[model samples]
Target: MQQNSLKLNSDKTQLLLIGSKSTLTKTNNLTLNIDGISVSPSHQARNLGVIFDSTLSLEPHIRQLVKISFFHLRNIAKIRPSLTPPTAEKLIHPFVSSRLDYCNSLLYGISNTSMNKLQLVQNAAARLLTHTKSWHHITPVLKDLHWLPVSHRISYKILTLTYKALHQLVPPYLSELLSPYQPHRSLRSTSARLLFTPTSKLRSFGDRAFSRAAPKLWNSLPILIRDSDSITTFQSRLKTHLFSSAYP
Candidate 1:
């Protein structure tokens, strides 16, 4: 920072330590001194509009998302009666859907409880748009809206990035994390268009990383989708595959 002539704003700067639960516990109440300025570790920190907790559980981020989404949902509900369904959907997309989808690829492999909370927000949004009662099943409403559930949406985002990375469309930093699978000898699975998945010792946290998750999701995809010739085609086929699984 000094070499770049950038001054550190100690008051605005936040220190966050990320690790598993047990590892975080060891660093409880930890603080740092930088250039005689004392900085304490924050339980959560915001970066690029995404909140990251020490444990990387993302529960705090989910709670914030739920709160903000419902706030917009309530405001939209006030004018829902006057606006047509299409107009309401447009409004919801910018206010709610964008927030849900923004940086959501980072949410892969989160706890089911956290995922469920997000699903409820999407369900409420769908219900608001369609005027569906709470008692009615949400799956059909979501399907009718052509919406993928929260979990599938996360998967969609990850798989899309993976596709881009594999095709050299993304930055080299991300693309380099993945490698084309090469076996010692050609076999029946050689044409599968799979990426090499590295073994992760820390299943709980390490497996959720992009290096592990990307290949796992990519390899699990059908060969047809994996062999897509273009980004547009890959996304279309990928959405269709996930939508079927989500609604079926």
Candidate 2:
């Protein structure tokens, strides 16, 4: 770093061991020495806001998100009585929803158990904004707000990036990972183009990769949506489809 006119900041540097639970347990005490500085392994580390754990569980990050979101939810609930619908929506969105949405693509392939942790926070936000009772159903409220649940929200982010990459709108590195799907036989739908889905077994890190998940989700979409005329149109139609299926 010094040779390149850059300096390493030990204060901000952290070393994390990433692997499966079984792998991490065998080397729990592992450490590293960089530039003669001894650095201990961290169970969890945050980089550019995404949190990664030694076991790659992401449980710690979701817990923190739930904690902070409820704090904002409580504050919003107290002040919601005084604010109009639009104003309450404005405040809760940036405070709560934005927190849930930021860098959420990393959450792909997380267990439903983990995904529900974040969904509960979103459910609370919906109820708070609408001044609904604690027991009130959140399905309708989310639909009215045009918000997708946490699981779909994560998929939405991934699909959006994939769409950009498909159109050559994103950087070359991202575009390189995606290829236009070619059928081995004649197809009836002229506009239906799919992404190649990589096959992998479950319960491994490779199964959770964007390369794998992106194509799986893309292929699951309806033919018309897969062949939308533009990104804007795709987004509009995609949200509607997700909203209807989730709420219906």
| Top candidate by TM-score | 1
lDDT of 1 by residue, 124-192 (tens): 999999999999999988998899998999999999999999888999999999988899998877778
| Quality of model 2 by C-alpha lDDT | 0.84
* Winning model by lDDT: 1
Mark the regions of model 1 whose C-alpha exceeds 4 Å error after superposition. Answer: none
- Pairs in steric clash, model 1: none
Clashing pairs in 2: none
Residue-level lDDT tens digits of model 2 in 1-248: 77899876666678988877767778846677776787888778988777888877788889989999999888888878899999999998899999999989889888889898999999888888887787877888888888889988888999888888888888998888876676777775324677877676655587778788788888888887877889999999888777777878
Candidate 2 positional error at 223, Å: 2.1
lDDT of each: 0.91, 0.84
lDDT of 2 at 211: 82
